[model samples]
Target: MNFTPLHRALGLPPCPLTDEILSDAVTSGVTETDDLDWKSELPPIKGLSQTDVPKDIAAMANSGGGMIVYGVEEHGKAATGRSDAGEFTEGHERAYRSVAVTAISPPVFGLEVHRLGTECRAVAVVIPASVDGPHLIYKNDFFGAPIRNDADTAWMKERQIEAMYRARFNERRRATEAVDSLFAEAAEGRDTVERAWLIAVAHPRVPGALTRLTRDEAREVFNDARTITLSFSKNTGIHPLDNVEYLNPRPGLRRWVAPNAATGDRSIWKESWVSVHHDGSVSLATAVGGHRMSSDGYWEGWQVEGRGVECAVADFMALIRAAARSLHLDEYDVRVGVEWSGEQPLSILTVDGSGFPYDGVSTPLRAFTSARSTVTASASDADFHRQTRELAEDCVNQGGITYLHVIEPLPEDEN
Candidate 1:
């Protein structure tokens, strides 16, 4: 296989060679072969003295790169023949790790030792060039010394040591340039945020009716949809209704219940508050005379039709959805539902003319108003009341028109 400059410099294949190919090469006396510059065989010297291994390692690392095949013969012209000789076994792998740790200076970091097939007869030491410096093999006499010349390893001369250091500096400079180029490309918008949403019309348990929306489209839906029913609890926070809660009450009933109730009887009162808080921030408290009044327990001592409550809720949701779509958020993040203030009773509508058939009778919609003082602690009473009154008026005028224009029911296919 073709080898990269880095690989050849390390004295190994570009990629790992199979044990079979390695064994065959060794048996064929390929160890004696020379690359354009250096020999591929282990030096005749037995048990590389702790000092020499580092120098040889450094030279191989610094020189364009070559592999040092251990346990093989370096015959000049022909096969010098094989011997059991200083073979490296599994134990040698561990020993090499130690040798790298103690002997080499500035370290040969990515060194790998591979056993060559069956007899443990051959081994290869792969050492990558150091990006740091001309490695010094700590010898007894010479102290910090480099490999002399590329030929049979000897003590390094002063000039050779300087050249090696220069090469290292150049490698680091090149690496920095490469990194800068990468950063420049990234900054130019090669990478960006990707958003996705899974909008399922039918529940997850059912199949064939799921729809998926991409980021831009979902954002459009969120920004344009009218009347969003978001459930927000200062305690629990806003979230989609859980499946059990979503399924327990019939869609019409669920639509009617306060957005805060999870199941029967339980109310999320203390945990929440609601406000229009838009550019034209408005609120409707129980005192106003419609559905909001009926729900808030402040009726004018007269009964109102349940359809009024349904229509108001549907209208509110339609407005929220439109606002969310205009804001460009995904539908998955938007939800709509009735709100309950635990401060008062929550009511359910009955089929018969009898008012509030549920165990907890509902208050009048008028009692529930747009007044901020009733919903928020920090809001001024007068300001809250004014905002609520304005909001009630807007809901009646602007919100009512917008709802009629957008929320008409779709015609069903009879086929």
Candidate 2:
């Protein structure tokens, strides 16, 4: 997540921590900065409660987050060489995590700990810029917020603490508003469409590096989305950006819009379109209903296919993942919704096991005009797939679907 500014300087990514990168840092003599620290030894397990590991972590978290590399020796604050920190086992990882959880107030989440090297092992902890911060360190009767001061850790001053708290609250509010605003924006012209439209929206708690995108960059993101959609193990029904004739910028909203056709028109879902925003929020609006016409040529609305709804939601999750990676974001508040043309309860057509409509089984299994589900989760969580399935199911369940069978199937071992 670009935990350290040195990542850009050294042409390195802040992930997949490797021995080669460590060695290169030593050769380059990279010095400790506001977002990077080096240590020669692991914290002792015996007196772990009294160690500075928690403080270091809190400092980094309070100051835009960074990495703490244990096993790197330093001279005059510059990385000198790698040291033999001995074997790092699961015990070591848990020990460090425990200290972080217990010693810090409002425990920091989403820490990425990596074990590197073999004979002479090392550990790297990647901490995200927390939205819940101004994290306080309370141990042995000392309670105060710690922040990174360039190459040093220091106690946060009263003014700084106040500011951090304000920023934290403001961020929470903005994130909440952003999620709703993005969803409403995606559903802007939904009323005109005769068929049902599926909408997926995601807003990161801590915004990322995507302040804007050039025309080429916007096209590249679409290409990446196409690649990501294809790579998904689950089938996504909607090809969101497939038919866009232009990639246009909406400077007022600080986002780029790629609409399928009728670009100047206010109506959406004439065809599918996607919007990628500067704050790492993204959304997709696509029509999911096919022809349902009568012999008299009167406009008859069709039922939303259950499989297509599930697939579109699944693909939307994939797009969120891609956007998170591109923007270097982690946690997000995501929402999925289904909207129809009229207030009349719209039916959802269930599919059989063979991926076709069931024969002689009452076709419209569930009915609802609209359904929405929201979740706050980390994109990198191990349980992401399960969570996504649950979210998609929850959205449909409101409409009485009960379950989402078309999304990615869970492992047999998982509950």
| Candidate 1 whole-model C-alpha lDDT, 0 to 1 | 0.35
Q: Model 1, which residues run further than 4 Å from truth? A: 1-16, 23-51, 77-79, 85-91, 148-151, 190-415
Clashes of 1: 63
lDDT of 1 by residue, 1-415 (tens): 2243224433674455555555455455442222212223433333644534666666665554455555544556333443343545445555555566567676555465555556545556665434556766666666665442534555667897788788777865664444333223222321111110111010100011122333343333323322132221111111222111211222121121112232332222111111221221111111111122334543321232233333333333333333322322111111111233233332333232342322123343322222111111112334323322333333323212211111222223113
Best candidate per TM-score, number?
Answer: 2
Weakest lDDT window of 10 consecutive positions for candidate 2:
291-300
Clashing pairs in 2: none
Query: 1-415 in candidate 2: lDDT tens per residue?
Result: 3435556548875555567777788889999988889989988886786888889989999988888888999998899888988777788777887888888887877787778788778888888888788899886677999998889999988999899899988987787788878888898976434777778888887777655766666666666666655543354343445545434533336777776663433323336777778777878887766522233332234466566677676667766776666666677777677766554456666556666543233234334433444333443333666666776776665544655656656676346
